[model samples]
Target: MIISKPNINKSRINICRENSQSLEDIQNQSSSSQNQTPIIDLTKAPELNYKYGRTSEIATLKQWILENHTRLITIYGLSGIGKTALTLKLISEITTQFDYIIYRSLDNLPKLITVKNELKQFLCQSLSKPLPEILDYFKSSRCLVIMDDLENIFQFGNFAGQYLTEYKDYSKFFQQIANSYHQSCVILISWEKPADIETLQSENQHTKTLHLQGLGEDAKAIFQEKDLKDDEKWEELITLYQGHPGWLNIITLAIKELFNGQVYQCLIDEDEVFLGDIEALLENHLERLSELEYHVINWLAR
Candidate 1:
């Protein structure tokens, strides 16, 4: 379910239908009409099940891609902050404007050469001779390439965005995309902003970053979806969790099972916020922090 703020000048976007055709079907259609069709490869992307309240994010991204022509964009946030969902929603709205829409994931930390070859092969499939470089396709076509789970390339125990020694080449690839003149856009989605993003944004108008945050009142939909009780107390619950869709969804399950769907019961302890199942999610985020960063958080808690 998509929940957007009213009066936002956004085209009506139908959520990805549950029974939509498979990737092979779409690829076949593109093959039949190579010149007119947009080559789409979403084999590695996550299915957007329920997206809540990213209307402004979508509009800003659309403007960057369609108007300002941003070449590189990094969407970063805390774990479970809806980065993937927002991008999926944006793709749904703007897919028709591009000649190609490709989605790749760095979750397994593939090498730079591997990724380059995969993208090159996919983008060059219709050509008589494969292009010498990936940028050639970018120059010849309007493409939207999304690389998700970028944090996988970074060292987990290091400060955020520090690439592992072996994955350092990905930084150069991103630099090339931002510095070179191209009609395509590459969006990187991660839990932490890459180290080069700040420098790139300051130096290049085409390079941009969007730091995603929580959903606000619109997150009430998740609670409603779970059939939680005490409708009037949802605002308090949302505020307590900062309207994080992932965290809210987890908490709703806890309330349903533990408090018999009564939200107030979970909120009764004013001094303590009950994390319930969210503690495990928090642990995953903490595991990625550097020792110093982890200590700083501990100090803050004290």
Candidate 2:
């Protein structure tokens, strides 16, 4: 469970002020002319404390959004790879560009109707209206909607992108958004791609995908944060963990206490590498693996 980092620094506060309006203040406004002001709801988004090693990815995303104004994009990655952090940083910098900005997490297992209704109410558009009528708001306004943790609705113990029957409506909605003309963009962040998304996305269309990978050298900062020693062996440790930020942070505590901050000594002492509640991070994947997949992994382990 990722918690939003509080006590944001002065620079971050200044960023909000620089926009002249903030997502936190959106609820205070009851004015009918909200279309003119940038309205945002980022209450569910985790607060960003630090970001590292995603400069190239951020640049590519900005180019796609600013240069082409792509309508739909998906960001997928393993847990704790900083997908949410990246998106939060991206929006904080560019929040002023859109008239409406909405961020919601699918981790709570929200229903498709509930999501549609929430958008309708926020935009002050009519309920019980046709889908076209509701979507017209996007056609007329520059809205940016981000749905995070989309894999929550997908079935467990299955291949990537298999949605549960109840939540499958989300795929259809996304497909419609990609195919139809709209001035807005909707981004989905998940551990796996949705089955329907691949069918709709094309080179000619304003649809694309970004798959997040572990941080490379920037992972050294996690050790620096923990005050781990043996700077010479940091890369070796990082390579062992595939530069996964969460794994590095967790394993560092054990190394510092058990091996006196000597990363090389820790590596020599423990062959298995990462420890302490690490399996929790892979719970979703574990639950979904097929019998054949389990057999393959078990056979390879021997």
Candidate 3:
């Protein structure tokens, strides 16, 4: 009897598909309770509602997520800089592109959320029908998991500049996930970037870090619609707001008073809090740096 070698490409293809299915099934058996949305659904909260701005950041993130080689990326920036909104927007737009997509906002994670435990919960939920342990699940499946503000859980060391973190334990887990999992991706969104984790990260050619900036023209349109006018006020308002949607929302409230909801109000109301808050806000969020950093930012702003 002649024993013929099996076809090389066909055999390899079958093996790949089988391995993929096995990994995917790990989180398919999720418990009923874990099926519900996490509390940080920014879309529903008034305080967390989506606003126009950060278009470039959203586009960058969406493109990065679609990359076959990129298994992870960070959408990092200062607080109230539209990171969460950009993240949610990207997730909503790209759900169909992934085998599995789950978003867990690390807005207020418990202090006890260790790397292992967090991974376990996510794996459990991702594997809804007969959820298995996280480690075994990632073995074969391709999944997209986003943990917003992961820096909160991580502790910092030498790598962190000002925003030090100690989430080194999570760093190792992420490396393992990326190396072993064939189609797994993770995104960490945070107010401050952690250098410790960045150091421990693999030298992947595909990993990306997107730092968000304020909005441009599109954001002005969003604000204009709210105040109900199309005039020079739109341009003036955009300049004042600097294209941060959250800030624009506050500005919108002020404009409503002057325009009486009849038109866009270019003039700052004498009694308005918006004008008062801008300077202080700039000092608070934008001036956390040393004197040199402040100078640099000011120079760049100008």
Candidate 4:
């Protein structure tokens, strides 16, 4: 499992209160008026420590949301490539622009109806009459809805991005979000892009996809933070692991424990790369591959 250090920062929600009003007066206001404050629900989100890089990626996402007003965005990449961290950082930068910010994980494979109903209820909490359709709420208010871990809804041992039979309705929901007019944005985070997303991108200007890649030199910070020595050898180690943050973190622990934080010792044998506990991380990604994909990988290995 990928583990992130606890984030010391907390999301601050600003409430607009009259400057002339006393604190007591604001507190005494009706509960309905108080509920007008934007709702932020990130309970399901993982705590993110200091993120290493992706300055350009964050800027592109911000442009899509703020300038282009894209309705649907799919951010996909291999696990540990910082998809979630990048998104959380993006949200932090642009939180105040939306009236509601909500996050959900599809790891448990919740049905589309259930997800829609919950979001609608949360978005419509301040209204005396809740909107009949989730899209109605999107039209009426600005929302940033982030759904993570969407790979869970996809079929295992199949072509990447094929949704399971039970979860197929999600494709329709996504299409609606992409095609229909809305003032809101829905971001899908997955290890594999949904098949419909590809089709949507071709036809809709508001729909977009971002394929995240390795951090390159920006990942050197991970080693620096771990206080590993032999700075000259850090680039070789990072390249061997493709600058994957999660894998690099696991390797750092192994280096510190077994090599006494000496980067030179770890790099003594250039012919062999030491995986240590990173084997488990690789297995997690490998186990999700289709038969054809597995065969292709096996052929490449030989």
Local distance difference test, each candidate: 0.82, 0.73, 0.53, 0.81
* Per-residue lDDT over 266-297 for candidate 4, one digit per residue giving the tens place of the 0 to 100 score: 88997888998778877887888899999999
Superposing all C-alpha atoms, what RMSD in Å does each candidate have to the true structure?
A: 6.8, 6.3, 12.4, 7.4
List the candidate numbers ranked by lDDT, top first.
1, 4, 2, 3
Model 2 per-residue lDDT tens digits across residues 47-130: 555446788888888888878888889999888778887887777666656767778898889999999888877655323554
> Can you give the TM-score per candidate against the true fold?
0.88, 0.82, 0.63, 0.87
lDDT of 1 by residue, 238-292 (tens): 9999989989988899999999999999999999999977899889889999999
Instruction: List runs of model 2 lying over 4 Å from the truth.
Output: 1-36, 125-132
User: In TM-score terms, which candidate is top?
Assistant: 1
User: In model 4, how large is the Cα lDDT of residue 122?
Assistant: 77
The 10-residue segment with the lowest total lDDT in model 3: 9-18
| Per-candidate clashes, comma-separated | 0, 1, 25, 0
Model 3 per-residue lDDT tens digits across residues 120-142: 65455434574455546544454
Count clashing pairs, candidate 2: 1
- Name the runs in model 1 displaced over 4 angstroms: 1-36
